[model samples]
Target: MRIGELAGQAGTTTRALRYYEAHGLVRPRRAANGYRDYDEAELRVVREIRALLATGFALDEIRPFVACLRAGNPSGDVCPDSVSVLRRKLAEVEAYIERLEAVRGQLREQLGGAR
Candidate 1:
């Protein structure tokens, strides 16, 4: 498929696809006419990138997952690199949640005193 088709099927914009290409996240071949020629596998890669981005994963953090996918794994998370990234991100989120809970407690105390 072409870039437009991949973008459409992946529910993303062609510009974003180009950005992914520029960032080396997705690589496509060039046709004789210089149009980008994407393989079906690229669609799977695009979906994975979009899914990770939706979940607050940074593009750099997503590289391991992409590498895992490209390595012929059934899924991205099955690889050790991807698993390590998952663990790190989960820890970051957990720490953030703890900070937020602490702030919420402070806010409740402030409200109680103001009343």
Candidate 2:
């Protein structure tokens, strides 16, 4: 299918598909006129990429996992080092959430005081 059709099927924008291609995540063949032609396997890969991206995984962090999946590796957690990366990301997210909560608490207090 074309980029538009693939994007529609994957529930994402064509620009996002192009970004994935640019990142070496998804590679589609070019037609004679230089149009992209995505196969079903490529479409599946796009879906997987979208899922990983939604999980807050960095592109660099997700690359090895994608490779493991493509290689039919039995264990998805083959990258032991990724555990530390995930931990750091989790810590960052937790810190962000705490800061947001503190801001929200202050806003609530200010609103109560004004009332």
Candidate 3:
């Protein structure tokens, strides 16, 4: 398929696809007329990248996942580097929850005092 077709199938724009290429994430071969010819496997890789991006993962953070996919892993369940990134993100989420709980407690106290 071509870049446009892959982009449509991957639910992203050609610009985003080009950006992914710029970052060395998606590598498509050049067609005879100099157009980018994408492989079917690229659909899987692009989907992975989009899914990770939707979850707040930066491009750098997504590299490991892409690497794992290129390494012939069909499922999106591998990648030790991604595991590490997720662990850190989980910790950050936990800390945010703790801070929110503290704020809730403060608000409760203020409400009680006002009452």
Candidate 4:
């Protein structure tokens, strides 16, 4: 299929597809006339990339993981660096959850105090 068809199938715009290609996330074959020709596998990869982006993974962070994803299993044992990244992201998420919980508790307290 062409770029337009792939973009439509992936529920993204052509510009996004082009950006993904430029970023080395997805690669499409070029026709004799230099138009992009995307296959089903490319379509699947694009969808996966989109899903990852939705999850707050930076493009650089997703790049290594994308390789692991394509390889079926992420290669190598978890290094200290990888663990650190995971730990930091976890702390960030935990902090956000804690903040939300505090806000919820405050709301409940306010409601009770109002009554």
Candidate 5:
């Protein structure tokens, strides 16, 4: 398939696919006419990349998962590196939630005082 077909299949844009290729996330081969030619596997990789990005994963943060996928894992997050990334993101989310809760408490106290 070409870039447009892969983008459509992956529910992303050709520009995004290009960006992914530039970032080393997806590597589509160049066709005879210099067009990017993508395979079904690359389409799967793009879907995985988009899914991870939707979950707030940075491009660099998603590298381990991509690596895992490229390594032929059934799921990207099964590898140790991907697992470690998940753990780190989980901790960050937890800390962010704690901070937000603290801020919420302070806001509630301020509102009560204002009343």
Candidate 6:
């Protein structure tokens, strides 16, 4: 397949695919005519990238998962590096939730006093 086909199959854009290439997430070979050539495996990698991005993972943060996938893992998160990233992200989300709860409490107090 080509860049456009990979983008369509991955539910992303050609621009994003290019960006991923630049960032070393997806590596497509160059055809003899200089066109980008992708395989089904690259399509699967793109899908993994998109799924992680939807969960608020930055491109850099996704590097470990990509490495895991490239290492032949059936699922990227099964690797130790990927697991570590997930743990870190979970902690960050927990901290964010705590702050949001504090803000909500303050807002509730303000509303009650206003009434």
Candidate 4: deviation at residue 112, Å?
2.7
Candidate 5 structure quality by residue, lDDT tens digits, 1-115: 9998998888999999989999999998998999999888898789999999999999999999999999999989999999999999999999999999999999999999998
Specify the poorest-scoring 10-residue window by lDDT in model 2. 73-82
The sequence of per-residue lDDT tens digits that candidate 4 reaches over residues 1-115 is 9999999999999999999889998889999999999988777777767876786766665565555445554331144444555576678889999999999999999999998
How close to the true structure is residue 74 of candidate 1, measured as C-alpha lDDT? 76
Greater TM-score among 1 and 3 belongs to 1
Q: Candidate 5 regions off by >4 Å? A: none
Q: How do all the candidates rank in terms of lDDT, highest first?
A: 1, 6, 5, 3, 2, 4
Error of 5 at 59 (Å): 0.5
Model 4 TM-score, 2 decimals:
0.69
The TM-scores, one per candidate, come to 0.98, 0.64, 0.87, 0.69, 0.97, 0.98
Question: Higher-lDDT candidate among 1 and 3?
Answer: 1
lDDT of 2 at 7: 96
Clashing pairs in 5: none
- Model 5 lDDT at residue 36: 91
Give per-residue CA lDDT, model 2, range 1-115, as digits (tens): 9999999999899999999889988889999999999987777777777876898877876676656556665533466554566677789999999999999999999999998
5-100 per-residue lDDT for model 6 (tens digits): 888889999999999999999999999999999998898799999999999999999999999999999988999999999999999999999999
The number of residue pairs in model 2 that clash at the backbone is 0
Pairs of residues clashing in candidate 4 = none
Candidates arranged by TM-score, highest first: 1, 6, 5, 3, 4, 2
Clashes of each: 0, 0, 0, 0, 0, 0
lDDT of 3 by residue, 1-115 (tens): 9998998899999999999999999999997899999998899999999998998789988888888888888755477876887888789879989999999999999999998
